[model samples]
Target: MKIILPVAGKGTRLRPHTHTRAKSLVQVAGKTVLEHIIERLKVLAADELIFITDENGQQIEAFMKRVFPDLNCSYIVQKDRLGPAHAVALADPRIAEGDDVLVVFNDTIFVTDLTRIPELCAEADGLIYSKEVEDYQRFGVNVIRNGIIVDMVEKPDTPVSRLAQVGLYYLKDANRFMQYLDQAIQAGDTVKGEFYLPAVFMRMVNDGLRFRAPEIDAWLDCGKPETLLETNRYLLEERHSCQGDLIDTVVIPPVFIADGVTVRGSIIGPYVSLATGTTVEASIVRDSIVNADCQVKDANLRFSILGNGVRLAGSPRRMNIGDDSLIEMDS
Candidate 1:
């Protein structure tokens, strides 16, 4: 199967960081979100990985080349910020007829038994990975009937089903899927002036396409600053284990300190992630994510996110500073 990664969104929710890098490049637990997705895809031994990117995605291409040099990959430029379905359609020419496509969105970090993909694909025309969410009104949810996905409703006032559709999908028939996309676009079937992937699935379901909504173990969102930091903490505690060099510092558990990080006379963690080359001096940090080459001196930080090369000092306070920033706060 081929993999399609739609990373063309401007990541407006994760500004500042997204201004310089793609949303998928945002680091969590010492690795970019894209890297985390790629690591999972590698297990499938996909034939080719197709990336749908936009103008601000040069860094994504460069990072891919630098990191996964040997992986079979291709890129397609989505000139217009149309929608998820539109972005997927941009790769139509590259997709072979009757090919099974696995589409994964960049903003969400998901964990599941991927080995069941083949089995799930065999039983349905398409498979959508969903998670049970309490706020079903805030998401597009799958309406399942007799264990088959009958419809998908976007933020309905009345609860249809709690199976909120996450950003993972497997289509057994790529050609048919593209045909549906074309029909939707031609018919001007749009919401808020953008074509949505879920609408296409709804159309397909009405036309007798069988879709199965499978439950995933975890669906961690990294769309905003707060959620990204929360995801960082969860991933560090659950997925990775690291030890940083602490000099006269009080270290907390469930923290990830990449190599080259130096903490002196500081108290760090219970959920902090410090990237390589970061130096923390006489500070207290917890529940934060500090990127590479950043310096935090005498600052007490909590629930903060500092981008790369940020130099933060002065009277110890929480901050959400971006990359290459220099700030001084008064106590």
Candidate 2:
């Protein structure tokens, strides 16, 4: 099956990091978010992979070429930042009539078996992955009836279900789905003049397109700053086992320390992730995330997220530090 990944959305929420790198390339637990998606798709034996990107297309294209050199990958630039539905429409040229296309959002990281999707597609015309999240109103919520999608409400004030779309979708009939995309865009019934994919899915429900829901094990949206840190912590504790390079430091298990980091005289983690070029000196950090080129000295921190180039010093007890910030702790 062919796969379409829409990575074009400029990550406005995830600034600084997204400013320098593609949102999909944001690293968590020492692996880029896109890397995790590509790995999972590869396991499913995805035949052709196409990326729809915006301004950061060149960077993503270069990165994908180097990483997945053997895969049949192609790139399409979306000139206008329309919306999700329009982004999928950009891939219409490459999609064939009978091809089954899995449209996955680039920002979502799924650490589960996507291989089961083919089987799910065999039974359903379209399949969407949803998870019971605390904030359902922030996501597109689907109302399913007898394994068929009956209605899709996008960020309704009162959500009917806690099941939120996890940004991964499977379409059995590529051409027909693309036609719905066309209808949604041409109708101009869009949110903020940007055509949304869920609207078409709702139209599909009325047209008997049959959408099924599959509950995924885990899904992380790395778009928000706080969620990025949370995802880092979760991914570190779940996937990464070892922290590279250490000296005179007591590290509890389930910590991720990136390369080129120098730690001396520190007690790190029940859950901690230190990015590259970070230095921790004579301090104790637990359940904290420190980004690259940051310096932590003589501090006791817990449950904090520190961004890149943060200078933390003195006897500071607890705080959340932003990037390129200097926090003079209480000595």
Candidate 3:
């Protein structure tokens, strides 16, 4: 089976962080978001993998080469931010003939092994991972009838179902998917003039193509600032021990502290991750995630996240700061 990972999005929602770094390269729990996706693919024994990226493609390729040396790797540059369907269309030449293809969004991280997808594809045209969410209006909602996807409403006012597509898809016939994509583009079936992959799926459904829906275990979205922090906390909490150092602080459970870190007169988390070369002084950090080479001093931080090389001083009531920032509280 071949895996096509569309990582071409600029991740505008992430703002300054994605401005300086690739969204897929963002680290959480001592691993990049892309790494977690790749690790899950390894369990599925996915033989070939294709990544669609833009300017950051070179760096991602280099990293993949170092980590997945034995896997068949290829890259397709999405020069235009057209849409998801356009992005998947770029994989046409990279995928082999008569091969099952799985197109997974880079921002969606699945905690369970999707190895059964290959077998599932053998019995279905395509399989989409679906999960229940409280707010269906924020995502593409699906309306199914007797195991068939009858309709799709993107951020609808009133959702018919709580199931939302988690961005994991398997297509047994690449040619069929490409044909629908072309038809949708020609017909101007797009969202804000940008062709969406879901449009193609709907087209397929209209043509009597059967697409299955699979319920996933854990589907995480690390595309936003708050979601990134929450995902980091969840990943850290699952681990046994995190790597970090201490100076003179009371460390608590579910915290990850990297090497060369010094904490003094502070109580660190029930769920916190401190990166290397970070220093915390005379403060209490709880339910927060601090990236590499950061410093926190004389502040009470709770349910917050700090990016790399951040320095905090003074005594703020609460904080939610980004990377490479110097915040001095009102002393």
TM-score of each: 0.97, 0.88, 0.91
Candidate 2 lDDT (Cα, 0 to 1): 0.81
Looking at candidate 2, what is the lDDT of residue 191?
A: 94
lDDT (0-100) at residue 324 of candidate 2? 84
State the local distance difference test value for candidate 1: 0.88
Model 1, runs deviating above 4 Å: none
Rank by lDDT, highest first: 1, 2, 3
**Deviating ranges (above 4 Å) for candidate 3:** none
For residue 226, give model 1's deviation from the true position in Å: 0.9
Q: For candidate 1, lDDT tens digit of each residue in 182-246?
A: 88888878889898998888889999989999999888899999999878877987755555678
Model 2, 54: alpha-carbon shift in Å? 1.9
The better-scoring model by TM-score among 1 and 2 is: 1
Candidate 3 lDDT score at position 95: 60
lDDT of 2 by residue, 208-276 (tens): 778888889888778776787678777776765555577899988678887788889889887787888
- Candidate 3: how many backbone clashes? 4
Worst 10 residues of 3 by lDDT: 239-248
The TM-score-based order of candidates, best leading, equals 1, 3, 2
